[model samples]
Target: MTSRSRPPRLRPLLLTVTLALALAAAGCGTEPAPDRVAGRSSSGDPAPDRAELEARASAAQIVAEHVWVTEAAGYALARQSVGVLGDDGFGSSYTAPDGGMLQLSVERRPHAEADCTDGSAAAGGSEPLWTCERDGEQWYRATESGHAYAREQGELVITVSGAREKVDRATLRSAARAAHRADDHELDQVLPPAGDASGRQPVERGDLPPMGDGAPNNDVGASG
Candidate 1:
């Protein structure tokens, strides 16, 4: 009986601790359902569709002084201009007098080079007789016959789509080359040699020629 009396004081403290824990658990238990419902409602916000993205891409424009070139010589001959448009806009346009004028806009990526490379000269009957090159931030031009005399120069860059499902640079280069081959009447033989989209073609990631000092020597094959 005496020992039972001595244990009585600690029982009150244990009871208080138990009561606090029970209250906290009860407070936390019932609110989860309501919180989850609120979170779900907030998370269900809608996002922009495909059309919106396309529109945004279209609106972005170049705003800088661009160096454009129209080369009319060599294995790679075409007239095209590439320039830095402002801080964001970058575009290139090409024209073949007898054929069509095709223009393409360059997409901007963080810390990327504006690659222009040694393009093959426009073969005989080729619509465009000019070739252009853009590497890093410079653009150059040469005449069709000036290619051998002008030398091969420019950079080839890889352009990947958002999903990486399509390669724009490869597509553009291939189409350009195809146009050249068609003019030369060597389309079937030089191109379409049994290759799928996944297969690598002639235009691998080629390196751009080193930029020499002074103005680009475009005075090849001058009419004296």
Candidate 2:
């Protein structure tokens, strides 16, 4: 799909909301300076390995494009979405067309990140990190609120009460678009079309962080 028409793809990774708040509380260095990926070290200071950097780059692109989060509450609850960062950033998440349930896709890249990480690392390393199913791509970092994840994958095939229902792809898109509009209305909320301060752009790769890799205090049930 064209970048403008692309679905919202970056919100699901916001599963790190708790940690982001904690980082902010600890005065974690002023939100990574907009263009910078706010990575921290074991000491809760900014630090990331090559892999982490790439993951942020991927996320930033997702954010720059039509980043959105999809949510629904009902018997037939299912969520799906797509988003693009720029010329090269394209990614999508959806329930499986078949019975497999949740599925995600993106192009290839240099280094990658997963959507979830086991929360056992130090403060800096403990941020909810994303992962790439593939490797060998560019790298960078991102700064976003965990609660803003665009897609709620865990609910792709959800059961409200006693009935099972799939997420409505159309509904998901609607919510995402609303979120973008909300961002637009807020001051100092717009992300630059180009890469963040790190000078990285979005990549066309599907990467998620390893499960349980984020801070133990965080819950990734939504993006899972």
Candidate 3:
């Protein structure tokens, strides 16, 4: 007599169990942590090298030339450059020991017209802006949180701002007046010309790495 055949379903059930166990074993293998990857950092990553910081400082200096500081005493400067969609710009911030801050930014657009008449006039007791006869070039001063000045010169637009109590209107005006177009050399340093190989340039300051909170001061202002 034939032995009672094991239930037909038993074979498929055993195969299913074996497959699931195999998958479970595979899942148990350790995965590389994200921080372990190159150019990546977990909370425990090491601080930037001295050379890197120095390079950034040098770049900042190139940008800071356009920013005029009335008094260099009791203040430290931090600067950064940004390039996007063929437009290039730089930003700088001067921070005083007493929590005072002044920010400046300059942007260059090849296609933009330097026209101030289109800008809405700032309101109510605000310092009047100065307009130049050339292409309606002008400066606008606003007293919101503090004092801010925006000016356009040819293809360059510059803006300066400072804390109301800490910085005076004249200082802002002076900075605006001091703003000048970045020369080709400075632009090349900040935004290297694209290489012919791929018609693309290497990554620039625009790719500034994320500096997490709790590091040094966050005194650098946002780019205009």
C-alpha local distance difference test of each model? 0.26, 0.28, 0.39
Model 1 scores worst on lDDT over the 10 consecutive residues at: 4-13
Instruction: Judge candidate 2 at residue 123 and give its lDDT.
Output: 66
| Candidate 2, superposed: residue stretches over 4 Å from native | 1-17, 26-60, 69-178, 181-189, 193-196, 199-224
**1-224, model 1: which lDDT tens digit per residue?**
55321100101122323332342333322211112111112234343343433332333322221112222211121111232333543433333323222232332323223222333344666454434554232233333222111111122211211111121333334333322101111111111122222211123332433465534455546664
After best superposition, candidate 1 residue 22: deviation in angstroms?
73
lDDT of 3 at 30: 27
Summarize candidate 3's per-residue lDDT along 123-174 as a digit string, tens digits.
Answer: 7634433222221233443333444566554555565666556666666565
Would you give me the overall lDDT of model 2? 0.28
* Candidate that beats the other on TM-score, 1 or 3, i.e. the better one: 3
| Reference-based TM-score, model 3 | 0.36
TM-score order of candidates, top first: 3, 2, 1
Report the C-alpha lDDT of model 2 over 118-205, residue by residue, as the tens digit.
Answer: 2224367765443312111211112331122232222121111100133233433332332211122111222323344332323333
Candidate 1 vs 2: which has more TM-score: 2
Highest lDDT, which number? 3
Cα deviation of 189, candidate 1, in Å: 39
